[model samples]
Target: MLESLWAEMPDRFRTIDLESNALDTDDLTAFLTDPRGPGFRIRFGQLPADMDREMAWCCWRIAELGGRVPVGVLRSLIRWLAATVEDHPELSGSLMRAAPREWERSIAAAYARRNGSLPGRFWQENVGSTLRRCYEILWAAYDQRPWWRREVWDPTLDPRIPLRPHEPLGNHAVYFQQLEPLWLRIAIQWYFKVSLETGQLTWSTVAGPQRTALQVFADWIAGHDPVPPPWLREDPAGIRAFMLDFLSHVRGLITQSGPNKGKPLSPQRVNTLVTCLETFYAFMTDHRETAAQVLDEAGWLRLGPYHAMLWRHGEKGRRTRVVRERRQEVIDDTAFSQIMSNVHLLGEPIEGGGLGDEQIMRILMLVARTGRRISEIRMLDREPLLPLDRLCGSTGPADADGAFVAKLRYQQTKIEQAPDTVLVDAEIVAIIDEQRRWADQHLGPRWAQGVTPKYLFLGHNMNRNADKPFPPSRINQTLAVFARRLDVRDSAGRLVDFNRTHRFRHTKATSLLNAGVPLHVVQRYMGHVSPTMTMEYAETLAETHQREFLRYHKVTADGRDLPVDTRDLYDMLELDKRTDRILPNGWCLLPPRQACDKGNACLTCDKFATDASFLPELKTQQHHTLQLIDERRQAFAARTGQEMSPDNVWLAGRTQEHDALGRIIDTLEQTGHRTDSDGRAVRGAGVAARTDALAAEHDEERRP
Candidate 1:
């Protein structure tokens, strides 16, 4: 079976055993025992370059001493060798020479020399089993075979690619291994590889959720009786049914890991999975010829409709489900200020409330201040800091003789565009300067001797020779440790985990918006391509608006009940309308018209309403009205030579207006309404004013 399968594979996949010489017991013993021996590197190097050399050496020692390797050990070696052969086609012949048959013969000879028959037909059964397993492993590794020559039918179920141990949510590794009809797996791998190399995705994204999506599809297939491969074409309705079932399964199933373990998968996760699978089907449709042998012409015709069904499923799921009900968690103002104060003290002794290593603290501060994505900050190049004087034509607000403001320039990976540059305050510049000095003192010499990029945040793993940017995981872990040490908590008193670095981004964006920064400015600050994306971060702070309403508009003068209908309030605010009218005293409730007939008489107009907070302004206006009335009376006396003239007739109307203004002011003052020195209504004062008005009305009613 193994030989036939090998023969059936394309010429590119066939391994040739060119070595004629058989290894002696003495040579095998030295090869296994000594790390310095030629065979040690030769055999282990066939695996991943980063494979554990010590573990491989230990496995070899066990095989040498016991005369028969464990099944797990053999399987592991075969998998590694197959992977090596797949990556380096030239090494296929070398790997073939070191196959399990040679190992079995050598082990049997060693046992026979010891006057012992090989234990329990282990050589006949286990060795043959291992060889067959090796064949299966090799077939899967060769999934990148040319589209035209790929396998049309699915191979026999290989034990090497077992069913998932648990419900696979985003397990790409398992899915890729289990995905049948060799061509389909190859095409999917091709799509992802192209996507990564073409800069359509980062390796982290591809390795993570993208792979998980494929795993979910594979799991969906496995849930069926006698699982069908993804390439097996069904009608559009059949495909729709399958997709609906997959979605149902995902929704019904509980998560196996993370904070939400044992809970039903969030709608967002399900929708994301659906979107990923939809993309996968679209990729398959684009590369339809790759699966030509498996999918007939009719099947190919169904791709468009099937892809449509997948899209609809995703869209419908999103529409019907309350995906992400909770507002985005952000660092509140008080918490943010506290964090900033403590940031610089991070690396100090724990007794002094320092978490130590001020580098991470500096990173957090940078994110909080700049609104930069964590990726942009983490992947900062060697000399990313630039003086503001250099960015602007000359010395500007950002520049002060020697203490110039600086801007950070780095590649924005989220959306491919020109390098993003954001201004940093003097404090942030100082932190950057400090970090630069630290890197120069610690990482410079070692980096100069190696080939790693000059990343600002260099990895600490010198043993592994990793001189790249520090992984986001490390930064998050560091934050989590510090958060626990600080005993941080939200307003609800729940422990605040700083593991999510994104909250800093939200905190920054929300702070900017709350500070009355223009939407476009916030958008630019956040490096968002669209204002809509920035709005998502900005809009999550509904609590801020609620607090503002309670602070300013919740009460009215005269202690009158000013009940606010939320829907009416929303209409009055009219946040979505660009033409919404906001007046000095209050918003104009009237529709747009030619002119104001009331002549800015907002206090007395039925269409207008004033908060008791405007009492001082109303009093000043009344004084101005009285002066106007007296001036008109003097003019009439001079012209007609009489105390009561036609001009004086307008004075009666002016007196009535003055009396009306007095009544309005008296009502507020009588109702106990008070204003601050600036004339803004005192918070909660409206409640008192309303209480007094209600009492006065009650007294008047009783007298009547």
Candidate 2:
């Protein structure tokens, strides 16, 4: 059997190159030397007459000896051996039995070596620490049978949440006592995959996203919101009734707003939500379908209607499109700029009490400039953003890789390339230097009361380890917000602003894009896996809005030199110049401002809303412009495939500008002087009035 098995094995493995492949070459030799290879040990050529038995015996022997070879390597060997020796069930079982223990030990060892200590491995050294708590997860140590649990009510429903002991709560209690550590580990692992893949360390994986969503859910539970799952019921009345009762308890933690004070559910949080929902839907669908098939054969829908009612629909039938329309005001550039200006940086005082504004600004600027995500930054070692010369190959700052590894070596970030890069613009470098000087002045060893944390930024409190860096969370928590408490108010004296440290980082990326940088370049600057990930910035273009309006309009030095494509590029503008929507009796769309310099009076000017019908035949040429827009949208979507949310109905159309076009139209309508009547030609007016109105209307409608 052994001879036949070896003969049947793929030729590639027969002459395996352990050195070339992702395998431990030395370890392979160690396994070959172990008793498992041949018990008493024999050359490969001189192997036993019964090679199959010899192989099985070798694996068992390794287990018996507590194999020196890594479990992963051993497992790999076993797979190769199993495939080669087809009739080796007993040997495979032994390898499987011992594989996990070895796997865990191997990872643990990596962390320990990297961190310089086992405990350091758990606290700060690597990405593994973020997920070190996951080591607590013992899959087999489940105390109870697998049970389906749902979100349960929490009695702490005041506007202010009350603290509770770990012993009591809802369904979370069991998880808290038995699985908290394990869940944390799982979250860490999940964060690891997503962060690495995204090219930006973020809690975008299910484990991390779920943690945030869970907190939001918990908050809702505490607040007593009761919105039922929409898919649970089909009838509008029933759904609404359930929603009304459940809305207070619905618990909305919309991460679309970005994370709050604590760690945010990564943007991948939505991806996780969809994936989990899809999985659940799949399982439930299959189960229900099978049950229904059985029930239908048995005439169950009528005879046992209750059974049918529980599932609501058949498996495939349950796949319904949810068309939820959102109503959000378009954020014009003026508003966006104001919001950003009001954002407090490191220098500003924390008006209501918080970290200094400049400090918060610096943090946000670093995070945003390098596209370092908020969560990733929280897990980072506090340090000044410095030139590469200062980062590595020098004693001034800890070596870049070494410092990052020690501070934020997460499983997700366990690579040569760190998600957070510390490149500083010349201006920002000046800011950082200023901050360091201030720190040296006020937080120096003599002025301060206790041993200061080694981190570049720190709170008043001393760090747990005087030698180690400050806790990422403690410093960030105190410094993340100052402007939010001070700024963001409406004329009515209500808070209309939503500010957070990460928001600045997000805004920085947005500003870069708006300043006319290429999407792909901006995506890279932000360290996003793809340009699409960067689209989540609030500056996303709507269907009616040109998110890159300035870029499109401004002729760059290169653009000016490039050969003009008069045929395709200017087709729309050309068409707009020749005609109007309909001829307006009053004036042309383009209004002259020869008399007055400032265009303020243009709002009440006489020529704003003229009818376009008077234009000879301009509207007929609109097809060209619309075509360009369509093409642009497709190109955008294709480039950033996942950038626009699938749920964004307007996003489905050409250009995000189109999505918020209503506002643009409002701007047109409110401008200049038009009759109080519907948008039309100002009939019977003098020739000047008619011409002026017509020109202004045409220009406004045609402005891209």
The models' CA-based lDDT, in order, is: 0.54, 0.36
Highest TM-score scorer: 1
Work out the TM-score per prediction. 0.58, 0.35
Candidate 2, residues 496-520: lDDT per residue as tens digits?
3333344445556666766777877
Candidate 2 deviant stretches above 4 angstroms? 1-175, 178-207, 211-274, 277-361, 365-372, 376-423, 437-455, 459-462, 466-485, 489-498, 535-539, 542-704
* lDDT per residue as tens, model 1, 1-704: 33344345434222232111243333243222233434322334444332223223333333322222343445435444454445445545433334456544544554454556653474457545645444434444344554323332122222222222111111123235565444456656666655644656554466568777777776667666766545444567776676777778777878999889999988778777777877778876776665454433334433564663474633436634331422436776566666677677665756876665655766787777777777777767767887555644664555454444777886575665633988777776776778778766764544323344456766543212223465567677778777776676666576656567777777777778778889898888788777777767666656556433333332232233345553354445665333434554444445455356756444434344344456677678689889998887788789989775434456655665576566556655654533233323322121243356778999999994
Lowest lDDT 10-residue stretch of candidate 2: 164-173
Looking at candidate 1, the ten consecutive residues that score lowest on lDDT are: 162-171
State the displacement of the C-alpha of residue 621, model 1, in Å, after optimal TM-score superposition: 18
Clashes of each: 10, 66
